[model samples]
Target: MAAFLEAVPARIRTLGAYQPGKSIRQAEQESGVSCIKLASNENPYGPSPLAVAAMQRELAGVNFYPDQDSLDLRAALATYAGVQPEQVLPTAGSSDLILLLLRLLLGPGSNAVGGDLSFFLYRIMTKSVGGTLKQVPMVNHAYDLDAIAAAIDHNTRVVLLANPNNPTGTLFTADEFERFLDKVPARVVVALDEAYSDYAEEFAVRRNVVWSRAFDYVRQGRNVLVLRTFSKAHGLAAVRCGWGAGPAELIGMLAKLRTLFSVSSVAQAAALAALGDLEHIHKSAIANAEGEAALSHALAEAGYPGVPTWGNFIFVETGEPALEVAAKLEKQGVIVRPMKAWGAPTAIRVSIGTSAQNELFLTAFRKVMPAH
Candidate 1:
């Protein structure tokens, strides 16, 4: 073990592995019962029929290598995002793009700024490249944009942000984001993770939250990278496809650093098909909005009110040890994510599931949680 440690970089040795949420099979194995998984913020409804068909058609061509540049898919995505094809870079997923950005921009002396409780990957990715992650404390369970801007300095290479931030599911508006960007130096690249942007847009009409202008920033020649994924509303998580839009020059740099043929043929095909299926996307978003409302209301009535979420998940303060609550719910055939890893020991993040799944979770929660 000492030899192995010596072989690895000191920075790499200090990092811990990412802990993903519990799977349905794992939950069932632990609980000895069938379980509904609401731990990962996946779309309850599955992928579009068109996307599935596209994957099926590409199966025979798996013997051949995928397009190295992902040209066709990039064109489709560019059109969808209202940007030039050169401005977009597709990858295996948004996480892949994050690593690529860090590899390209970070080094020993540089650092990245982000909310303390935002996406966990920001810290891991930064540290992996021997860079510091300056985490600014959040305000009211949301990103403190001003504090984050203040944290940036000469050595700051990146500013990482997640819309509908993970764990908390809170966001800042477009005006706020623009003001924050004004304070950022031109050399610092702002990597905006918009994995949950679709859901945020769906809820925006009712909630009055202005969606981000990251893409607009790209068009205006800002050093901003807008990362998005098909894993959520598109229901293409298994396909592992996502894209980043930025200035053409920045996109070129990321493309050069991207692993060769990182996105498989199956993933590219499914993502291409999913891009055109706006109806399915819209339906999924509407269903998620409905589910969020229902679940939030139910939890509130049960004396565990959840934070207003723009993502397809609700962050609830359980007023109990979150891991204990999660374990009890798992035993009752419901699986949720405890926020202990994110430093909120009394909170759990519950993905908004189908109405029936939500009902099952509520029933299980009632059985496990003591009444107020």
Candidate 2:
């Protein structure tokens, strides 16, 4: 090992980097075919038109530094989320806020608790700070809230959870979350990641499932942080803007530790614009619901029934090695996420795309997936 490598912390040396889904360009290059990527759970409809105009308008200001506090964007998010502006902290993305929280609360002797197979970032961020992440085993592909609460101990500094969780698209009800929150110690901060909250909320209304009450907790002065992002339904993934709302004091502390100008001027402007475009978000949700239903029905007919999903993705068992299945689909110009890293070698998580993209995926899937 190099001398510099020897000096590096063991946690830093052993940490595994996050593996993102394959991009369209990468897939096209490897397969020699044009591809539609459904692996990343991005909005196929693209960013809000208002957001595009905002970004274009903000282009001339790139030469200047962004507002260090992101005051305007935070105020917009506060209005949208029904929180006070002082209680909101804007970051580059929700992932960045996750890191900031861990750095503030976790240390060598501390730990965080989260469900196994939840968002991969909770584990990565906790470990990155030399803190342990107790991944309580999930039940039926959903978060086992009771098990997660039981896993928390005196040294546990944070609890990480994602509503309509990534990879699985499973969510707990508002009532369930309330009960779980009651069990958590006041000393431990709960970071409720609502990255897919918009989709989940729409699904909740149609399916009669209760959506998360994270913001409610924040309003009630609970020791919790609600994290949301513009990367998903808003289609601002490229710009990378997100925020965390919690107690005013906690938000103030995180704001102090936040990197200067972390959110670019363009990103801030785009997110602000996206926040006002309720029509685009609603349209995206309606399309996602329809695509999810169509894909689920089609997959079930083709012998691949998937878990009921609240987010814009479905977790389906392929009954074969997932990586092999994913590779085969890639060759047919479709891309999806294999769940091997999350421990289900026979499952793949497919993001709901636009009608045309979804059809393209189904065609490729039918060709690659053997008939039962």
Candidate 3:
């Protein structure tokens, strides 16, 4: 029986599970202090007050199942992204949607292309669905679109590029994406993972520039999907609501595989309200941008090189092994994400928090690496 178990599909047997950041409570348990967690790029500001209020309103009807189609939320997202409601497919979160797309698009003998140091989940999902993971090495901590374009081959079924990539906090400009789009083959689906799009400086979540144009590719019969999430800006990571914008045919295929009622009634309600509250989203964006700038300046002044970031985080090259530095910071109640899993051994990716939390992280970082 043991030998039989070991003979499972080669894809499943060799696959590595996705490793998320340690929770603040876990950090506190390990360090014996109330920790400041700038690890996962979760919004430190809790969900918008409007979203919380809406969730409370829906609590009275907990017995009822949510609309499986996510009609209201999808409609709201369409309005938010300036697309028709048919183009939007809301899900439990972006992670689930990503897996769903991978399952629908790629399988054994196929491959998905993404940056080596971008989100690691893409590789995990691709491999889990029996697809080869083709990683193009990033140039100077940013997604090298030309290299990624060059890596695509005949077996490639999909291409996942995270604009304002995670862990690195680096972004692709509109022109860069245009150049890549001109070269990308029409046969494969290109997914621009814009989970942190709301946190960007120039491009707010609206119908403008590369963002709107990316979906236009889908509308023009090109296979492209733009992934977005409410987790970051809405601060609804707990609620776990997100969505995708793409061609109706592609979205419909993913929808067939999407788990019915995966999103709870409360989550749908909360996310609906979150989408409507643009003022609150604006405030959160401002806070993240300011926090990122302050952290970047501080890192520079302290003689540490940090990546130029448009998202709500800073990726710092710590010179020492990031895991060791992160472990040391853990002892001081600071939990920043180590990028070893993403093939960055000497870098720590810190999410933007409130001013007080940022100060705590900076203080801990200084203590961990003294002026030398």
Candidate 4:
């Protein structure tokens, strides 16, 4: 009989599964106390009221399949991006888009490039396609675009760039990107995953340049695709819908690869409705900004300085081992993410929660860290 481990591909067996943040249910079950979870960078404020109503309305047609091509959502996303619907492609989420793009762009002999301390799913997705993953190390805990561009070779098919990058939450500037774009060839695809773009702060100094305009490069016919999710600012994480905005030709090819009716009717309906409630998103941003500032300040006062963040999560260096700190905190009714899988055993990622949640987390963190 064939052994189960032997049946799996070498790369698949070698790759670690994606480690999600600890669930609140799991924590409460393990601990005697009710837990406040600040692990997953989820919106502590729930989904838009309009989106909830839309989702409830969709329950009436639960038996019907979603539009295979997500036409309505595409049109909505296109309007937001100032592009044609043909240039937009919706997926189950940004992760789904990443998975689909990995399949479409990679094969046995190609390579994908991204940062070492980035959304690690890109590495797994690239490896699953039998492609080499070139993880360029960050400079000063931020993306070194120059190093990333220099890492690309002839066989490099895709470059995964996360704006306001995950874990570390560092964002590259428009001028920095413009310079980097000059080095990249038009043939190679650059995927800009902007899932955390909702939490990005607008600097009046820049006057309008906040999020990465990688999608605009796509509109200009560059080989770029900007990925966004309803999961973040729209607070529709459970709905599981995201999109890729790119050149029409690439989007057309990607559409051929999209799973038919993979997006649920509820997700589609909710995402469409979420787009209209711009004020909810603004409120979310304000709350997130306040939470992040408070948490960072608190962590600094405890002598555990955090990385400079543009996203809602704060990655702080724990004086002790990260997993150990997290375990202790979990027992004390607070939950944060341990970053051992990302190769940083000294860091714990704490998401910006609601005002009360943040206070609870801070209280628990101080209580546990001192005693641990």
Higher-TM-score candidate of 1 and 3: 1
**lDDT tens readout by residue for model 3, 9-41:** 888988888888898898899889888888888
lDDT of 4 at 226: 91
lDDT of each: 0.91, 0.91, 0.85, 0.85
Across 288-310, the per-residue lDDT of candidate 2 in tens digits comes to 99998898898888888889899
How many steric overlaps are in each model, in order?
Answer: 0, 0, 0, 0
Q: Residue 61 deviation, candidate 2, in Å?
A: 1.2
Q: Give the per-residue Cα lDDT of candidate 4 at 15.
A: 77
Would you list the clashing residue pairs of candidate 1?
Answer: none
Candidate 1 structure, TM-score to reference: 0.98
Comparison by lDDT, 2 against 4, better one:
2
For residue 106, give model 2's deviation from the true position in Å: 0.9
Q: Give per-residue CA lDDT, model 1, range 1-372, as digits (tens).
A: 777578888889778887788999988999999999999899889998899999999999999999999999999998888899999999999999999999999989999999888777788899999899999998889999988998999999999999879979998889988998999999999999999988999999777767787788988989899999999999998889999999899889989998899999999999999988989999999999999989999999998889989999999989899999999999999999998887789889999999999999999998999886
Every model's TM-score: 0.98, 0.98, 0.95, 0.95
TM-score pick, better of 1 and 4: 1
lDDT of 4 by residue, 53-116 (tens): 9999989898888788777888888999888899998889989989888898898889999999
